[model samples]
Target: MALNLNDLGIFVQAVEHGSFAAAGRRLGMPKSTISKRVAELEAMLGARLIHRTSRSFSLTDVGRDFFEHARASIIEAENAETIVRTRLGEPSGTVRLTTSVPTAQFTLAPLLDRLAARYPKLLLSLHVTDRFVDIVQEGFDIAIRSHQQPLPDSALVQRRMAAHDFYIVAAPSYLDRYGRPEKPADLAGHNAIVANAAETSWRLLAADGTLQRALVNPVMAADEPFVLLRAASSGIGITVLPTSVCATAVIDGTLERVLPEWTAGQITTTILMPHRRGQLPAVRAVVDFLLEHADAQSGVLNSLANA
Candidate 1:
């Protein structure tokens, strides 16, 4: 029997959800039915699509490539359907988005909520992490990232959402109690709640626009940005953080932006996805919403970039 589109879809889901049972649940089919479809498809192709154990399933290398190709076709079919539906003016579907914890919590989360409210049928699956995740392998529709430069992957396309403003900050209590420094060199005497150890050796642009470098030895350190921020707020030490992380606190006067006249390079926030034609309908909708909202927030980061 010829392999059917439905079976191909089942195969895609099995790879995406990582198990026959999960794929069966998503497709509203019995586990046996899902397994039978996949097995049939693999038999028709004369290649094993998955390496399966009693409890787990993983794509074979051929299966990975096949999935990429199959997903593109699936996206095209979905988009064709959407084009017809959207012409009649109704937008709906599930979009899986990923971002760092801070970006999702402080920046994208509220905007997503607003988007979801406007489009009642649209389901947004949000995955938050501080580590860089592979969107295709992870089955994510899109990702939000912050970096000093563009991602070098040719397989991925990136859209600049906004530039991020990084600030050197310390609690008022700590600065007042320990004596505020008038210059970067003076930070050597003070304690720092370090986020990145290399960040301790900070290089800043001076008032006269001269480059100034400082080698600081932090008394406290944390791998997580939030932990560093919390330590700084508790008067443990000072920290260098992005405005997205510190903006609310700065506005609330809980944490103060220190060395305002001096700052390091700006970090640009970006939206990333696999480079492909006929992208999924749901992903496109989320991307449109993000771009619109990003333009609204552009000025916030541009100021820091130009400064």
Candidate 2:
């Protein structure tokens, strides 16, 4: 009799979730589908694993015994996979990644090239968006997020990457036209090009380690970092953005730093995975490769080109 390991997983899921309907919901299938798979698993084993009823269900004595066995089998299978991933010389598989457009362009894009050169067998697929992504439901192997503070509680496992201060920048022409702000509060009267309308408020860290809060009027708003950079470099207004997004403009003098004595909020880049355990060798290698390229001294741009 042929047995399906997936049926075992579904059986365990049914038992743990208390009902086929619940398990199906978690697994993104129908309850009838769950029931059919469980029945097939029982047929293959030649022993019933659940006692079905109109309203509820119960496990038979044999079912009770087999549930533990099924769960153990799943765990052992996971362990075997872990062993294979860790013991392998070179990790090779397709790793699907999702992140914002800016990160994809200035960060992950170059790294993907590096990964291909370093591990020729490995494959990568990237998705770029600024919307919230359900990592599990969306089927992405990994996700990246940059935030000013710790993210809200979630089930996804997180790995901290490079952290760089948010830089408030403007074109030299803008400074010359509007005059540089002498203090954080001085920015209140200036035009502000923001990532979005919602980001009009900024918290700046002064030279003395004091916190300064300033709210600027939004003159223009764009979701993509490069768009915002282009606007800022065109003498539109001062904008506060993560250093990774502004590093290149600052280096080439397209944009000049505003309030050199103060920095905007510190932003941290994080790598998020669906689960900490049972990570594929390819996924693990991709994560480590990213961490290896994370430059603490410099965020991206020039560093990524050379590193």
Give each model a TM-score. 0.77, 0.74
lDDT of 2 by residue, 13-104 (tens): 78866788877866789989999999888877888889889887889999999989887888788668768866775776678788988888
Tally clashes: model 2. 0
Task: Show where candidate 1 strays beyond 4 Å.
Answer: 1-3, 11-35, 39-73, 196-200, 207-209, 276-278, 301-307
Position 219, candidate 1: lDDT = 85
* Clashing residue pairs in candidate 1 (N, C-alpha, C atoms within 3 angstroms): none
lDDT for model 2: 0.81
Question: Using alpha carbons, what is the TM-score of model 1?
Answer: 0.77
Q: How does each model score on lDDT? A: 0.77, 0.81
lDDT of 1 at 13: 78
